[model samples]
Target chain A: MSVYPISSPPSPQAVMDTSFWSLCCYCGLEPYLWKVWARPIWVPTVVKNQIFYHAGDYPDQQAFQQAEHEGLLAIRDPQIRITQFRSGEREVLSLAQEVSATALIDDFSAHRYAGTILGLDTVGVLEFLVSLLEAEIITLAQAESAYHQLVQLRATNQGWLKWAYNQIKQRGGNP
Target chain B: MATHPQLPLTPEEVAELHRLIAWTGLEEPEALHKLVEAGLAALRLEAALHLYATAPLSTGEIAEQTGIPRGQLIRTIQERRVAPYEDPTIDQPALYRDLDERLKRRVARWKGQA
Candidate 1:
Protein backbone atom coordinates (compact mmCIF):
# COMPACT_ATOMS: atom_id res chain seq x y z
CA MET A 1 0.00 0.00 0.00
CA SER A 2 1.23 3.46 -0.87
CA VAL A 3 1.70 5.97 1.96
CA TYR A 4 0.12 8.79 -0.07
CA PRO A 5 -1.93 9.30 -3.26
CA ILE A 6 -0.06 10.67 -6.29
CA SER A 7 -1.18 13.94 -7.81
CA SER A 8 -1.35 14.73 -11.55
CA PRO A 9 1.92 14.15 -13.46
CA PRO A 10 4.30 17.01 -14.02
CA SER A 11 3.83 19.08 -17.20
CA PRO A 12 5.10 17.50 -20.41
CA GLN A 13 8.07 19.92 -20.70
CA ALA A 14 9.58 20.00 -17.21
CA VAL A 15 13.36 19.86 -17.55
CA MET A 16 15.19 18.81 -14.35
CA ASP A 17 18.62 20.04 -15.53
CA THR A 18 17.36 23.42 -16.71
CA SER A 19 15.95 24.24 -13.26
CA PHE A 20 19.56 24.60 -11.98
CA TRP A 21 20.37 27.11 -14.72
CA SER A 22 17.14 29.03 -14.07
CA LEU A 23 18.19 29.39 -10.43
CA CYS A 24 21.70 30.34 -11.61
CA CYS A 25 20.29 33.11 -13.90
CA TYR A 26 18.84 34.73 -10.80
CA CYS A 27 21.77 33.91 -8.49
CA GLY A 28 21.62 36.94 -6.12
CA LEU A 29 17.84 36.52 -5.61
CA GLU A 30 18.03 33.74 -2.96
CA PRO A 31 20.94 31.30 -3.36
CA TYR A 32 20.78 30.08 0.23
CA LEU A 33 17.42 28.25 -0.06
CA TRP A 34 18.57 26.10 -3.00
CA LYS A 35 21.91 25.49 -1.23
CA VAL A 36 20.07 24.25 1.84
CA TRP A 37 17.05 22.44 0.41
CA ALA A 38 18.06 21.23 -3.06
CA ARG A 39 21.65 20.23 -2.30
CA PRO A 40 21.85 16.60 -1.13
CA ILE A 41 22.94 15.78 2.45
CA TRP A 42 26.23 14.21 1.41
CA VAL A 43 27.39 15.89 -1.82
CA PRO A 44 27.35 13.26 -4.56
CA THR A 45 29.57 13.52 -7.66
CA VAL A 46 26.59 14.79 -9.71
CA VAL A 47 25.35 17.31 -7.12
CA LYS A 48 28.88 18.63 -6.81
CA ASN A 49 28.87 19.11 -10.59
CA GLN A 50 25.54 21.02 -10.43
CA ILE A 51 26.89 23.23 -7.63
CA PHE A 52 30.01 24.04 -9.68
CA TYR A 53 27.88 24.77 -12.75
CA HIS A 54 25.70 27.16 -10.73
CA ALA A 55 28.74 28.81 -9.14
CA GLY A 56 30.44 29.40 -12.55
CA ASP A 57 27.71 31.91 -13.56
CA TYR A 58 27.49 33.98 -10.36
CA PRO A 59 28.02 37.74 -10.97
CA ASP A 60 28.89 38.56 -7.37
CA GLN A 61 32.46 37.91 -6.17
CA GLN A 62 31.37 36.90 -2.63
CA ALA A 63 28.88 34.34 -3.93
CA PHE A 64 31.56 32.74 -6.12
CA GLN A 65 34.04 32.70 -3.19
CA GLN A 66 31.37 31.22 -0.87
CA ALA A 67 30.77 28.40 -3.33
CA GLU A 68 34.54 27.69 -3.44
CA HIS A 69 34.93 27.71 0.37
CA GLU A 70 32.03 25.31 0.75
CA GLY A 71 33.98 22.73 -1.35
CA LEU A 72 31.61 23.13 -4.34
CA LEU A 73 34.52 24.26 -6.56
CA ALA A 74 36.81 21.25 -6.00
CA ILE A 75 35.01 18.60 -8.13
CA ARG A 76 36.81 17.93 -11.45
CA ASP A 77 36.64 15.96 -14.67
CA PRO A 78 39.05 13.01 -14.93
CA GLN A 79 39.56 13.38 -18.69
CA ILE A 80 40.43 17.09 -19.15
CA ARG A 81 43.69 18.94 -18.48
CA ILE A 82 42.55 22.23 -16.80
CA THR A 83 44.94 25.25 -16.90
CA GLN A 84 44.18 28.70 -15.47
CA PHE A 85 45.23 31.66 -17.63
CA ARG A 86 46.08 34.63 -15.41
CA SER A 87 45.75 38.06 -17.11
CA GLY A 88 49.17 39.49 -18.29
CA GLU A 89 51.05 36.78 -16.34
CA ARG A 90 53.37 34.25 -17.99
CA GLU A 91 53.06 31.75 -15.13
CA VAL A 92 50.06 29.57 -16.00
CA LEU A 93 48.89 27.43 -13.07
CA SER A 94 48.17 23.85 -14.17
CA LEU A 95 44.92 23.32 -12.23
CA ALA A 96 45.13 19.55 -12.81
CA GLN A 97 48.42 19.47 -10.86
CA GLU A 98 47.36 21.95 -8.13
CA VAL A 99 43.78 20.75 -7.54
CA SER A 100 40.96 19.74 -9.86
CA ALA A 101 39.32 22.86 -11.34
CA THR A 102 35.58 23.21 -10.72
CA ALA A 103 34.98 25.45 -13.75
CA LEU A 104 37.09 25.68 -16.92
CA ILE A 105 36.41 27.64 -20.12
CA ASP A 106 38.44 27.75 -23.35
CA ASP A 107 37.46 30.31 -26.01
CA PHE A 108 38.40 28.09 -28.96
CA SER A 109 36.71 24.92 -27.67
CA ALA A 110 33.11 24.37 -28.74
CA HIS A 111 31.97 23.44 -25.22
CA ARG A 112 32.54 25.22 -21.92
CA TYR A 113 33.28 22.71 -19.14
CA ALA A 114 31.85 23.58 -15.72
CA GLY A 115 32.08 20.80 -13.19
CA THR A 116 33.32 17.37 -14.31
CA ILE A 117 33.56 17.05 -18.11
CA LEU A 118 32.09 13.60 -17.41
CA GLY A 119 28.66 15.37 -17.15
CA LEU A 120 26.20 15.40 -14.27
CA ASP A 121 24.64 11.98 -13.57
CA THR A 122 20.88 12.63 -13.16
CA VAL A 123 20.43 9.12 -11.75
CA GLY A 124 22.15 10.20 -8.54
CA VAL A 125 19.86 13.23 -8.32
CA LEU A 126 16.82 11.02 -8.94
CA GLU A 127 17.95 8.58 -6.23
CA PHE A 128 18.66 11.41 -3.76
CA LEU A 129 15.27 13.03 -4.42
CA VAL A 130 13.48 9.68 -4.08
CA SER A 131 15.28 9.07 -0.78
CA LEU A 132 14.21 12.52 0.42
CA LEU A 133 10.62 11.73 -0.52
CA GLU A 134 10.74 8.33 1.18
CA ALA A 135 12.21 9.91 4.30
CA GLU A 136 9.19 12.25 4.28
CA ILE A 137 11.38 15.32 4.23
CA ILE A 138 9.66 16.17 0.93
CA THR A 139 6.37 14.75 -0.20
CA LEU A 140 5.75 13.17 -3.61
CA ALA A 141 3.05 15.80 -4.16
CA GLN A 142 5.58 18.57 -3.42
CA ALA A 143 8.01 17.10 -5.98
CA GLU A 144 5.27 17.02 -8.59
CA SER A 145 4.35 20.60 -7.71
CA ALA A 146 7.99 21.67 -8.01
CA TYR A 147 8.26 19.92 -11.36
CA HIS A 148 5.15 21.72 -12.72
CA GLN A 149 6.45 25.07 -11.44
CA LEU A 150 9.81 24.45 -13.08
CA VAL A 151 8.04 23.64 -16.35
CA GLN A 152 5.97 26.82 -16.19
CA LEU A 153 9.19 28.74 -15.55
CA ARG A 154 10.42 27.52 -19.00
CA ALA A 155 12.06 24.23 -17.97
CA THR A 156 11.77 21.93 -21.03
CA ASN A 157 12.22 18.14 -21.46
CA GLN A 158 9.58 15.40 -21.41
CA GLY A 159 12.06 12.64 -20.57
CA TRP A 160 13.15 14.21 -17.23
CA LEU A 161 9.54 14.75 -16.13
CA LYS A 162 8.55 11.17 -17.04
CA TRP A 163 11.62 9.83 -15.24
CA ALA A 164 10.80 11.77 -12.07
CA TYR A 165 7.14 10.72 -12.23
CA ASN A 166 8.11 7.05 -12.58
CA GLN A 167 10.51 7.36 -9.66
CA ILE A 168 7.79 8.70 -7.39
CA LYS A 169 5.42 5.96 -8.52
CA GLN A 170 8.08 3.29 -7.90
CA ARG A 171 8.43 4.54 -4.31
CA GLY A 172 4.79 3.52 -3.81
CA GLY A 173 2.90 6.58 -4.94
CA ASN A 174 -0.67 5.75 -6.01
CA PRO A 175 -1.36 7.38 -9.40
CA MET B 1 36.68 -72.50 33.40
CA ALA B 2 34.49 -74.00 36.21
CA THR B 3 30.92 -75.01 35.17
CA HIS B 4 28.27 -72.95 37.02
CA PRO B 5 24.84 -74.47 37.84
CA GLN B 6 21.85 -72.34 36.68
CA LEU B 7 19.08 -71.87 39.29
CA PRO B 8 15.47 -71.82 37.95
CA LEU B 9 13.22 -68.79 38.96
CA THR B 10 9.90 -69.48 40.66
CA PRO B 11 6.73 -68.55 38.65
CA GLU B 12 5.98 -65.63 41.03
CA GLU B 13 9.49 -64.18 40.53
CA VAL B 14 9.17 -64.41 36.73
CA ALA B 15 5.70 -62.79 36.90
CA GLU B 16 7.03 -59.97 39.12
CA LEU B 17 9.87 -59.26 36.63
CA HIS B 18 7.36 -59.19 33.76
CA ARG B 19 5.02 -56.86 35.72
CA LEU B 20 7.90 -54.40 36.44
CA ILE B 21 8.92 -54.37 32.75
CA ALA B 22 5.28 -54.06 31.61
CA TRP B 23 4.97 -50.68 33.49
CA THR B 24 7.09 -49.10 30.63
CA GLY B 25 4.25 -49.75 28.03
CA LEU B 26 6.66 -48.87 25.13
CA GLU B 27 5.94 -50.91 21.93
CA GLU B 28 9.26 -50.38 20.07
CA PRO B 29 12.41 -52.17 21.30
CA GLU B 30 14.41 -48.90 21.21
CA ALA B 31 11.62 -47.06 23.08
CA LEU B 32 11.45 -49.85 25.67
CA HIS B 33 15.21 -49.63 26.21
CA LYS B 34 14.99 -45.81 26.52
CA LEU B 35 12.12 -46.14 29.05
CA VAL B 36 14.12 -48.70 31.06
CA GLU B 37 17.14 -46.36 30.98
CA ALA B 38 14.83 -43.58 32.44
CA GLY B 39 15.57 -41.05 29.60
CA LEU B 40 11.89 -40.15 28.97
CA ALA B 41 11.21 -40.42 32.72
CA ALA B 42 13.90 -37.83 33.47
CA LEU B 43 12.51 -35.42 30.75
CA ARG B 44 8.95 -35.83 32.18
CA LEU B 45 10.27 -35.15 35.68
CA GLU B 46 12.06 -31.97 34.48
CA ALA B 47 8.89 -30.74 32.68
CA ALA B 48 6.82 -31.43 35.85
CA LEU B 49 9.35 -29.50 37.94
CA HIS B 50 9.19 -26.51 35.55
CA LEU B 51 5.36 -26.56 35.69
CA TYR B 52 5.43 -26.80 39.48
CA ALA B 53 7.78 -23.82 39.75
CA THR B 54 5.85 -21.59 37.30
CA ALA B 55 2.23 -22.74 37.78
CA PRO B 56 -0.11 -20.89 40.12
CA LEU B 57 -0.56 -23.91 42.38
CA SER B 58 0.57 -25.01 45.81
CA THR B 59 2.71 -28.17 46.14
CA GLY B 60 -0.31 -30.05 47.53
CA GLU B 61 -2.52 -28.69 44.71
CA ILE B 62 0.08 -29.76 42.05
CA ALA B 63 0.27 -33.27 43.59
CA GLU B 64 -3.58 -33.47 43.51
CA GLN B 65 -3.87 -32.00 39.93
CA THR B 66 -1.13 -34.17 38.34
CA GLY B 67 -2.37 -37.40 40.07
CA ILE B 68 1.29 -38.45 40.44
CA PRO B 69 1.37 -41.18 43.15
CA ARG B 70 1.85 -39.44 46.52
CA GLY B 71 5.03 -41.44 47.31
CA GLN B 72 6.65 -40.39 43.98
CA LEU B 73 5.58 -36.73 44.55
CA ILE B 74 7.27 -36.73 47.99
CA ARG B 75 10.44 -38.26 46.47
CA THR B 76 10.48 -35.64 43.62
CA ILE B 77 9.97 -32.78 46.11
CA GLN B 78 12.87 -34.12 48.17
CA GLU B 79 15.08 -34.27 45.03
CA ARG B 80 14.07 -30.76 43.86
CA ARG B 81 13.66 -28.46 46.88
CA VAL B 82 11.66 -25.18 46.58
CA ALA B 83 13.68 -21.93 46.76
CA PRO B 84 13.90 -20.33 50.26
CA TYR B 85 11.81 -17.25 51.10
CA GLU B 86 11.38 -14.75 53.94
CA ASP B 87 7.67 -15.67 53.79
CA PRO B 88 6.09 -18.62 51.98
CA THR B 89 2.94 -16.60 51.13
CA ILE B 90 4.81 -14.64 48.41
CA ASP B 91 4.06 -15.85 44.84
CA GLN B 92 6.81 -16.78 42.36
CA PRO B 93 9.74 -16.46 44.78
CA ALA B 94 13.12 -15.43 43.34
CA LEU B 95 15.31 -18.32 42.16
CA TYR B 96 18.40 -17.04 44.08
CA ARG B 97 17.77 -16.86 47.83
CA ASP B 98 21.50 -17.03 48.56
CA LEU B 99 22.16 -13.98 46.32
CA ASP B 100 19.49 -11.96 48.16
CA GLU B 101 21.16 -12.88 51.49
CA ARG B 102 24.54 -11.70 50.11
CA LEU B 103 23.02 -8.39 48.94
CA LYS B 104 21.51 -7.85 52.42
CA ARG B 105 24.92 -8.45 53.99
CA ARG B 106 26.59 -5.90 51.65
CA VAL B 107 23.89 -3.32 52.48
CA ALA B 108 24.46 -3.90 56.21
CA ARG B 109 28.23 -3.35 55.76
CA TRP B 110 27.60 -0.05 53.96
CA LYS B 111 25.02 1.04 56.56
CA GLY B 112 27.56 0.37 59.37
CA GLN B 113 30.14 2.67 57.62
CA ALA B 114 27.57 5.45 57.25
Candidate 2:
Protein backbone atom coordinates (compact mmCIF):
# COMPACT_ATOMS: atom_id res chain seq x y z
CA MET A 1 0.00 0.00 0.00
CA SER A 2 1.20 3.52 -0.77
CA VAL A 3 2.11 5.47 2.33
CA TYR A 4 -0.06 8.48 3.18
CA PRO A 5 0.10 10.98 5.97
CA ILE A 6 -2.37 10.05 8.74
CA SER A 7 -2.51 12.71 11.45
CA SER A 8 -5.49 13.53 13.63
CA PRO A 9 -5.36 15.11 17.01
CA PRO A 10 -8.23 13.63 18.94
CA SER A 11 -11.20 16.00 19.19
CA PRO A 12 -14.72 14.66 19.70
CA GLN A 13 -15.82 11.25 18.53
CA ALA A 14 -14.96 8.24 20.70
CA VAL A 15 -13.64 5.11 19.02
CA MET A 16 -12.14 1.98 20.57
CA ASP A 17 -9.67 -0.22 18.75
CA THR A 18 -9.70 -4.02 18.74
CA SER A 19 -7.20 -4.51 21.56
CA PHE A 20 -8.91 -2.01 23.87
CA TRP A 21 -12.33 -3.46 23.07
CA SER A 22 -11.05 -6.96 23.73
CA LEU A 23 -9.55 -5.79 26.99
CA CYS A 24 -12.92 -4.39 28.05
CA CYS A 25 -14.64 -7.66 27.23
CA TYR A 26 -12.07 -9.80 28.97
CA CYS A 27 -12.00 -7.52 32.00
CA GLY A 28 -15.79 -7.46 32.39
CA LEU A 29 -16.04 -3.67 31.91
CA GLU A 30 -18.42 -3.67 28.95
CA PRO A 31 -21.53 -3.00 31.00
CA TYR A 32 -19.79 -0.26 32.94
CA LEU A 33 -18.58 1.44 29.74
CA TRP A 34 -22.00 1.64 28.13
CA LYS A 35 -23.64 2.53 31.39
CA VAL A 36 -21.27 5.32 32.38
CA TRP A 37 -20.61 7.02 29.06
CA ALA A 38 -23.61 8.61 27.38
CA ARG A 39 -22.25 8.27 23.91
CA PRO A 40 -21.94 5.86 21.05
CA ILE A 41 -18.61 4.03 20.90
CA TRP A 42 -17.27 2.98 17.52
CA VAL A 43 -14.94 0.23 16.45
CA PRO A 44 -13.26 0.17 13.10
CA THR A 45 -15.01 -2.01 10.54
CA VAL A 46 -11.88 -4.09 10.16
CA VAL A 47 -11.88 -4.80 13.91
CA LYS A 48 -15.50 -5.87 13.78
CA ASN A 49 -14.71 -8.14 10.86
CA GLN A 50 -11.42 -9.54 12.10
CA ILE A 51 -11.67 -9.99 15.89
CA PHE A 52 -15.23 -9.48 17.01
CA TYR A 53 -16.83 -11.83 14.50
CA HIS A 54 -14.35 -14.59 15.32
CA ALA A 55 -14.29 -13.99 19.08
CA GLY A 56 -16.02 -17.20 20.00
CA ASP A 57 -14.06 -17.42 23.23
CA TYR A 58 -15.22 -14.01 24.49
CA PRO A 59 -17.83 -14.19 27.23
CA ASP A 60 -19.78 -11.01 26.43
CA GLN A 61 -20.96 -11.35 22.87
CA GLN A 62 -24.57 -11.25 23.92
CA ALA A 63 -24.00 -8.05 25.86
CA PHE A 64 -22.30 -6.57 22.82
CA GLN A 65 -25.28 -7.54 20.71
CA GLN A 66 -27.54 -5.83 23.17
CA ALA A 67 -25.44 -2.65 23.04
CA GLU A 68 -25.52 -2.68 19.26
CA HIS A 69 -29.27 -3.11 19.36
CA GLU A 70 -29.53 -0.14 21.70
CA GLY A 71 -27.31 1.97 19.38
CA LEU A 72 -24.64 2.42 22.05
CA LEU A 73 -21.97 0.58 19.99
CA ALA A 74 -21.38 0.66 16.27
CA ILE A 75 -18.87 0.06 13.49
CA ARG A 76 -17.40 2.47 10.96
CA ASP A 77 -15.02 2.48 8.03
CA PRO A 78 -11.95 4.69 7.96
CA GLN A 79 -12.30 7.13 5.10
CA ILE A 80 -8.56 7.63 5.15
CA ARG A 81 -6.32 4.59 5.04
CA ILE A 82 -3.10 5.21 6.90
CA THR A 83 -0.38 2.68 6.20
CA GLN A 84 1.40 2.42 9.49
CA PHE A 85 1.56 -0.14 12.29
CA ARG A 86 -0.53 -3.31 11.98
CA SER A 87 -3.49 -3.12 9.62
CA GLY A 88 -6.01 -3.09 12.45
CA GLU A 89 -4.20 -0.28 14.22
CA ARG A 90 -3.85 1.64 11.00
CA GLU A 91 -7.58 1.36 10.58
CA VAL A 92 -8.18 2.56 14.12
CA LEU A 93 -5.97 5.59 13.64
CA SER A 94 -7.46 6.29 10.26
CA LEU A 95 -10.99 5.94 11.58
CA ALA A 96 -10.14 8.19 14.49
CA GLN A 97 -8.82 10.78 12.09
CA GLU A 98 -11.81 10.37 9.85
CA VAL A 99 -14.14 11.18 12.70
CA SER A 100 -11.92 13.36 14.91
CA ALA A 101 -12.29 10.82 17.67
CA THR A 102 -10.52 10.09 20.94
CA ALA A 103 -8.86 6.79 20.03
CA LEU A 104 -8.81 4.15 22.74
CA ILE A 105 -5.73 1.92 22.55
CA ASP A 106 -4.20 -0.98 24.57
CA ASP A 107 -1.45 -2.48 22.44
CA PHE A 108 1.76 -0.94 23.71
CA SER A 109 3.46 -0.36 20.36
CA ALA A 110 0.34 1.05 18.77
CA HIS A 111 -0.31 3.05 21.91
CA ARG A 112 3.13 4.57 21.56
CA TYR A 113 2.57 5.51 17.94
CA ALA A 114 -0.93 6.79 18.58
CA GLY A 115 0.40 9.25 21.12
CA THR A 116 3.94 10.21 20.02
CA ILE A 117 3.52 9.72 16.28
CA LEU A 118 -0.15 10.18 15.48
CA GLY A 119 -0.82 12.66 18.29
CA LEU A 120 -4.25 11.19 18.94
CA ASP A 121 -5.67 11.33 22.46
CA THR A 122 -6.16 7.86 23.94
CA VAL A 123 -7.61 6.13 27.00
CA GLY A 124 -6.21 2.95 28.55
CA VAL A 125 -8.06 0.39 30.68
CA LEU A 126 -6.56 1.60 33.94
CA GLU A 127 -7.58 5.16 33.19
CA PHE A 128 -11.11 4.07 32.44
CA LEU A 129 -11.37 2.19 35.73
CA VAL A 130 -9.91 5.14 37.61
CA SER A 131 -12.34 7.47 35.90
CA LEU A 132 -15.19 5.28 37.09
CA LEU A 133 -13.85 5.43 40.60
CA GLU A 134 -13.39 9.19 40.52
CA ALA A 135 -16.92 9.67 39.27
CA GLU A 136 -18.36 7.76 42.26
CA ILE A 137 -20.02 5.55 39.67
CA ILE A 138 -18.19 2.44 40.89
CA THR A 139 -16.58 1.75 44.23
CA LEU A 140 -12.85 1.39 44.70
CA ALA A 141 -13.31 -2.35 45.34
CA GLN A 142 -14.94 -2.79 41.92
CA ALA A 143 -12.04 -1.02 40.27
CA GLU A 144 -9.55 -3.22 42.10
CA SER A 145 -11.43 -6.34 41.04
CA ALA A 146 -11.34 -5.19 37.40
CA TYR A 147 -7.65 -4.37 37.63
CA HIS A 148 -6.95 -7.84 39.05
CA GLN A 149 -8.80 -9.46 36.20
CA LEU A 150 -6.85 -7.32 33.72
CA VAL A 151 -3.54 -8.44 35.25
CA GLN A 152 -4.59 -12.08 35.01
CA LEU A 153 -5.68 -11.67 31.41
CA ARG A 154 -2.64 -9.82 30.04
CA ALA A 155 0.04 -11.14 32.38
CA THR A 156 1.31 -7.57 32.30
CA ASN A 157 2.61 -7.16 35.79
CA GLN A 158 3.97 -3.70 35.07
CA GLY A 159 4.87 -1.15 37.72
CA TRP A 160 2.88 1.52 35.87
CA LEU A 161 -0.29 -0.48 36.37
CA LYS A 162 0.53 -0.57 40.06
CA TRP A 163 1.04 3.15 39.85
CA ALA A 164 -2.38 3.46 38.31
CA TYR A 165 -3.82 1.20 41.03
CA ASN A 166 -2.33 3.52 43.61
CA GLN A 167 -3.77 6.49 41.79
CA ILE A 168 -7.17 4.84 41.99
CA LYS A 169 -6.79 4.11 45.69
CA GLN A 170 -5.48 7.58 46.45
CA ARG A 171 -8.14 9.31 44.40
CA GLY A 172 -10.88 7.17 45.86
CA GLY A 173 -9.83 8.37 49.35
CA ASN A 174 -8.95 4.93 50.59
CA PRO A 175 -5.91 4.59 52.84
CA MET B 1 43.30 7.78 -7.19
CA ALA B 2 41.94 7.52 -3.65
CA THR B 3 43.34 4.69 -1.56
CA HIS B 4 40.47 2.34 -0.56
CA PRO B 5 40.38 1.05 3.03
CA GLN B 6 42.00 -2.37 3.39
CA LEU B 7 41.41 -5.51 5.45
CA PRO B 8 44.29 -7.98 5.99
CA LEU B 9 42.99 -11.06 4.24
CA THR B 10 44.38 -14.59 4.84
CA PRO B 11 45.62 -16.72 1.93
CA GLU B 12 42.32 -18.62 1.67
CA GLU B 13 40.32 -15.39 1.87
CA VAL B 14 42.47 -13.83 -0.87
CA ALA B 15 41.77 -16.82 -3.13
CA GLU B 16 38.05 -16.61 -2.38
CA LEU B 17 38.10 -12.84 -3.03
CA HIS B 18 39.84 -13.42 -6.39
CA ARG B 19 37.11 -15.95 -7.36
CA LEU B 20 34.37 -13.53 -6.32
CA ILE B 21 36.07 -10.63 -8.20
CA ALA B 22 36.28 -12.72 -11.33
CA TRP B 23 32.60 -13.74 -11.20
CA THR B 24 30.88 -10.61 -9.74
CA GLY B 25 33.38 -8.01 -11.12
CA LEU B 26 33.21 -6.14 -7.77
CA GLU B 27 36.55 -4.62 -6.72
CA GLU B 28 37.85 -5.57 -3.25
CA PRO B 29 36.94 -2.27 -1.62
CA GLU B 30 33.36 -2.25 -2.95
CA ALA B 31 32.85 -5.90 -1.92
CA LEU B 32 34.21 -5.28 1.56
CA HIS B 33 32.12 -2.11 1.97
CA LYS B 34 28.93 -3.93 0.93
CA LEU B 35 29.68 -6.81 3.26
CA VAL B 36 30.38 -4.42 6.11
CA GLU B 37 27.14 -2.59 5.47
CA ALA B 38 25.24 -5.88 5.56
CA GLY B 39 26.97 -6.85 8.81
CA LEU B 40 26.20 -3.50 10.41
CA ALA B 41 22.56 -3.79 9.41
CA ALA B 42 22.35 -7.22 11.04
CA LEU B 43 24.15 -5.92 14.12
CA ARG B 44 21.72 -3.04 14.43
CA LEU B 45 18.75 -5.37 14.17
CA GLU B 46 20.11 -7.64 16.89
CA ALA B 47 20.88 -4.74 19.17
CA ALA B 48 17.47 -3.26 18.58
CA LEU B 49 15.81 -6.57 19.43
CA HIS B 50 17.87 -6.92 22.59
CA LEU B 51 17.14 -3.36 23.71
CA TYR B 52 13.47 -3.92 22.94
CA ALA B 53 13.13 -7.19 24.85
CA THR B 54 15.22 -6.18 27.85
CA ALA B 55 15.22 -2.41 28.32
CA PRO B 56 12.45 0.17 28.56
CA LEU B 57 12.86 2.02 25.27
CA SER B 58 9.83 3.36 23.49
CA THR B 59 9.28 2.52 19.83
CA GLY B 60 10.28 6.07 18.94
CA GLU B 61 13.43 5.78 21.04
CA ILE B 62 14.34 2.51 19.33
CA ALA B 63 13.86 4.05 15.89
CA GLU B 64 15.82 7.16 16.85
CA GLN B 65 18.68 5.22 18.47
CA THR B 66 18.85 2.69 15.69
CA GLY B 67 18.57 4.04 12.13
CA ILE B 68 15.59 1.87 11.21
CA PRO B 69 12.69 3.67 9.55
CA ARG B 70 9.47 3.77 11.58
CA GLY B 71 7.38 1.69 9.17
CA GLN B 72 10.06 -0.98 8.81
CA LEU B 73 10.65 -0.96 12.57
CA ILE B 74 6.96 -1.43 13.27
CA ARG B 75 6.83 -4.35 10.85
CA THR B 76 9.92 -5.93 12.34
CA ILE B 77 8.54 -5.76 15.88
CA GLN B 78 5.18 -7.05 14.69
CA GLU B 79 6.79 -10.05 13.02
CA ARG B 80 9.06 -10.78 15.98
CA ARG B 81 8.27 -11.75 19.58
CA VAL B 82 9.36 -8.43 21.07
CA ALA B 83 7.19 -7.16 23.90
CA PRO B 84 6.53 -3.52 24.68
CA TYR B 85 8.75 -1.91 27.32
CA GLU B 86 7.60 1.35 28.87
CA ASP B 87 10.39 3.82 29.51
CA PRO B 88 10.34 4.71 33.17
CA THR B 89 12.32 7.87 32.61
CA ILE B 90 10.32 9.40 29.77
CA ASP B 91 7.20 7.59 28.66
CA GLN B 92 5.79 5.71 31.67
CA PRO B 93 5.25 8.66 33.97
CA ALA B 94 4.05 10.78 31.06
CA LEU B 95 1.72 7.98 30.00
CA TYR B 96 0.18 7.77 33.45
CA ARG B 97 -0.33 11.50 33.53
CA ASP B 98 -1.78 11.56 30.04
CA LEU B 99 -4.24 8.88 31.03
CA ASP B 100 -5.21 10.78 34.13
CA GLU B 101 -5.87 14.00 32.21
CA ARG B 102 -7.69 12.46 29.27
CA LEU B 103 -9.94 10.28 31.37
CA LYS B 104 -10.62 13.21 33.66
CA ARG B 105 -11.71 15.25 30.69
CA ARG B 106 -13.88 12.37 29.56
CA VAL B 107 -15.47 12.04 32.97
CA ALA B 108 -16.05 15.78 33.16
CA ARG B 109 -17.61 15.72 29.74
CA TRP B 110 -19.89 12.91 30.79
CA LYS B 111 -20.91 14.97 33.80
CA GLY B 112 -21.74 17.97 31.65
CA GLN B 113 -23.84 15.78 29.39
CA ALA B 114 -25.62 14.38 32.39
Per-residue lDDT tens digits for candidate 2, residues A66-172, read: 66777767877777787775455777778877777777766566666777787887666666777777777678777777887766543232644766677766766
Error of 2 at A55 (Å): 5.9
CA lDDT, candidate 1, residue A95: 26
Top-scoring candidate (lDDT): 2
Which sections of candidate 1 miss by over 4 Å? A1-65, A75-128, A134-137, A169-175, B1-114
Q: For candidate 2, what is the DockQ?
A: 0.08
DockQ of each: 0.00, 0.08
True contacts kept of 2: 0.10
All predictions: root-mean-square deviation over Cα? Answer: 34.4, 12.0
Q: In candidate 2, residue A65 scores what lDDT?
A: 65
**Residue B104, model 2: Cα distance from true site in angstroms:** 3.4
- What is the Cα-based TM-score of model 2? 0.61
Which tens-of-lDDT digit does each residue in A34-139 have in candidate 1?
A: 3223221122233233334333443333443454465332332233333322110001112222332111111111011222242311121322343345445466
Reference-based TM-score of each model: 0.25, 0.61
Each candidate: what lDDT? 0.32, 0.60
What TM-score does each prediction get for chain A alone? 0.34, 0.80
Error of 1 at A3 (Å): 30
